[model samples]
Target: MLKAVSLGPGDLSLLTPAARWAVEEAEVVAGYKGYIELIPDEVLEGKIVVSTGMMGEVDRARQAVEHARAGRKTVMVCSGDAGIYAMAGLLMEVLESEGLLKTVPFEVVPGVAAFNAAAALLGAPLMHDFASISLSDLLTPWERIEQRLQAAASADFVIALYNPRSRKRSDHLREALGIIGRYRRPSTPVGMVRKAYRAGQFVEAVPLKAVDVDKVDMQTVLIVGNSATRLVEGRMLTPRGYHRKYAL
Candidate 1:
C-alpha cells in the first residue's frame, strides 16, 4: 500500500497517528528533503529514501508508484496538509488514470496545515469564513491568483496566503496585498507566520497598511482578516467562539 502522509507544516508534534505509522512501517520513504529530515534518522534508518529538489514534482510521483508496484511500502510525504497544494491531489489524479488504484492501496493522512498553525500564531484571525490562496505562478498563473484575491477581499472573507515568496516571484505577495488593501480596510489585521513547526520560528502582527513586504519568504504563511477583523491584546483571533450580544 502506498500512503501519502502530511508532516503537518513544520512541527513534528502535529504529525497524526496514521501518518507516523505510515512513516515508521514503510520500506521506502519518498519525499522532499525538508520533509524527510523532519522524520528522525532512527525512524527511517534502513529505508530507501528519494529526494526531489523542487523540480519534476510529477516525475517523483511516478517513481513512488513504481516502488509501490514492486510491493514496497512507500510513503510519499508532503509538507503542511497533503491535499492543500500538496502532492496528494496530483498523485491521485494520475494514479487513477493509470489504473494503479486497483493494484495498490493508498491513503492520505491529514495533518495540521500551515493556515491553522499560522492563525494560531496570530490568534483567531480566521475564526469566521476564510479562503486560502497561493501566489505561486508555477502551475496556476499569477492572473488567476489576482482574481481570487479581489474576490476574497470583496466578499469580506479572511484570507490565508501561502507560498508567499520565491526567488523570481518575490513581488507577487506584495502585489496581492496591494490588491486586497484596496477592497478591505487599511487597518485590517495581517499575521505573518514563519517556520510554524521547525526551529527558529517567528510570528509577527501587522495592520494592512503597515506590513513590510520584505520580511516574507517561501516558508511563510500570511493571514489577512476581513473588514470585521481586529487585533485584540496581542493576538489575531477570529471571533468564531461565542458572541457577546447578550452580555452587558
Candidate 2:
C-alpha cells in the first residue's frame, strides 16, 4: 500500500486520524526532511524513514513507489493536503510511468491546507469566491503566474497566494501586488498569516497598500480580499451576501 499523506500546515495535533493511521501502518515513511521531522518520534519509531531535502521530490517519490512495488507499506508525507502543491501528483505520475497505476494500491490522505489554516486564523476572508495562485516560477513560467494574478484580480476574486516570496524571487510578491492593485482598491483588506497554527505564528490584516513586502516569505500565506471584504474588530471578513436576501 502506498499513501500520500498530508502533515497539515504544522502542529502534530492537527494531523488527521487517517494521515496518522497511514503513517503508523506504514513500513516506510518518506518525505521532505522538514516534514519528516514533524512526525513524532513515537510514530516514526521502528519505521524505515526516507527523508530528503529541498528539490528532492522526484527522488523521494521514486523511492516510495519502489518500496510500495516491493510489497512494503509506504507513506509519502507532504506539508499540506497531498493534492495541493504536494507529492500526490508526482507519485501518481511515477506510478503511471512504471505501469503500476492500476496495479498499485494507492491513496491520498487529505489534511488541512495552508490556505484553509491561514483563513481560519484570519477570520472569514474566504466566505466568498476565491482563487489560489502560487508565485513560484520554478516549474511554471513567470508569465503564466503573472497572467493568473491579473485574471484573478480583474475578476474580483479573493486571491490566496502561496509561495509569495523567496530569496531568489524577492520581487515576485511585490510584482503580484502591483498587478492586483490595478483592479483592487488600495484599501482592500489583505490578510497575512505566517506559520499558521504553528510556532512563530504571525497574523495580521492590513490594507493592500500597507503590506510590508519585505517581511513576507515562502512560509507566509497571503489572502487578498475582494471589494466587499472588510476589517472588522481586527478580523478580516468577506461577506457572503446573506444580508442581501435575508435579515441579519
Candidate 3:
C-alpha cells in the first residue's frame, strides 16, 4: 500500500497523527529534499529514504509506486495537504497512466494546509466564504489564473494565495494585486504569514494597498480579506453571520 502524507507547513508539531503513523509504518519514504528534511531524524533512521530536488516530482512518484508494487510499504511525503497542489494528484495521474491505479492500493493523509495554518495565526479571516488560488504559472497559464483572481476579487471572497511569488516570478504577485485592486478597496485587510508555525515565522496584517510585495515569496501564504472583513485589535476577522442570526 502507498500513502500520500501531508507533512504540514514546516512544523513537525503540525503533522497529523495519521500522517506520522504512515511515515512510521512505511519502509520507504520519498519526497522533495526540503520536505524530507522536515521529518525528525529518528523517524527516518534505517528507512529507505529517497530525496529528490525541485522539478523531479514525476521521478519521485514513479519511485514510490515501484516500491509499493514490490511489496514494500511506501509513503510519498508532501508539505501541506497532499491533494492541494502537491503530490497526491500527480501520483494518481501517473498511476492511472501506467495502468496501476486499481492494482495498487493507496490512501491520502491530510494535514494542516498553509492557508488554514496561516489563517489560524492571523485570527479568523476565513470565517466567511473563501477561495484558494495559486499564482505559479509553471504548469498553469497566467491568463487562467488572472480570470480566477478577477472572479474571486469581484465576488468579494476572502482569497488565500499560494505560491504567491518566487525569485523568477517576482512580478506575479504585483500583477495579482493589480487585478484584485480593481475590485477591492485599497484599505482591505490583507494578512501575510511566512513560514507559519515554524522557525523564523513572520505574521503581519496590512491594508491591501500598503502591502509590501517584496516581503512576499513562495514560502508565504497571503489571505486577502473580503469586503466584510476587518482588523479587530490587531487581528484579522470576518464575521460568520452569528451577529445577524443571533444576539451576541
Candidate 4:
C-alpha cells in the first residue's frame, strides 16, 4: 500500500499505530530529513530510504512514486496531520496530474495536528468558535493571510496560527501577532506549543502582550483565543461546550 501518514509533531509516542505500520512495513520510505531520525531505526534496516530538506516536495513525491512503481510498498511521512499541508496533498496532486492514481493504491493515515496538540496542551483553546490559518508565505501569500487573520479576528473567532515563522521569514510571526493584537485584547490568552509530543515538547500560555514572536518558528504553532477564553485550573479551553451545555 502506498500510504501517507502523519507523524504528529516530532514525538514518537504520538505516532499512531496506523502510521507505525505504514512506516515499518513499507519497503521504501520517503520523508523530509527532520523525519529521518523519527523513523524507527530497527524498522528501517535495509529499507530504501529517500529524504530531502524542506520544500523539495515535487521531487520527493516523484522519488516515492518511482520506488513504489519498482514493486516496493512505499510510505511517505509528514509531521503533524497528513491532510494539513503535508505530503498527502502533494502526493495526490502528482498522482492526479499524471493520471497515476489508478496505477497505485494510496491511503492517508491521520495524526494529531500541531494546532490540536497545542490546544490540548493549553487547555481547550479551540472549544468554541475558531479559525486556523498558515502564515508561511511559501504556499500562501502574506496579503491573503492578513485578510484571513483580520476576518477571523473581526468575526470574534479564536485563531490558530500555523507555520508561524521560519529562518528565511523570521518576521512573519511578529507581523501576524501585530495584526491579531489589533483586534484581540492585550490580555487575551495565547498558546505556543513546540516540539509537541517530541522529547523536548513544550507548551505555554501567555497573554497576548507577553508573547515573544522572535522565539517562534515553523516548529511552533500559536493559538490566540478570543476574549472570552479563560484558563480554568491552568487549562486553555474556550467556553463552547461548557457554556452551551449548561445554558438555560
Give RMSD (Å) of candidate 2 vs. truth: 1.1
lDDT string for model 3 (1-248, tens) is 88899999878788888999999999999999999999999999999998999889999999999998888999999988897889999889878888888989989998898888999999999988899999999889999999999999998899999998866779999999899999989988999999888889999999999999999878889999998888888789898864597766
Give the whole-model CA lDDT for all candidates, comma-separated: 0.86, 0.93, 0.91, 0.84
Model 3 ranges with Cα > 4 A deviation: none
lDDT of 4 by residue, 1-248 (tens): 57888988767777898888888888988989888778768989999889998777789999998787667899998888888878898898887887879988989999998888888788888867889998888767789999998999888899999888866878888888888888888988888988877778878888889998877767788889897887566567677753455645
Instruction: Name the better of 1 and 4 by TM-score.
Output: 1
Ranking by lDDT: 2, 3, 1, 4
Question: In candidate 4, which residue pairs clash?
Answer: 11-197, 11-198, 122-236, 123-236, 123-237, 124-237
Residue 220 displacement (Å), model 1: 0.7
Report the poorest 10 consecutive residues by lDDT, candidate 4: 239-248
Backbone clashes counted, model 3: 0
Q: Which lDDT value does model 3 have at 183? A: 91
In candidate 2, which residue ranges exceed 4 Å CA deviation?
none
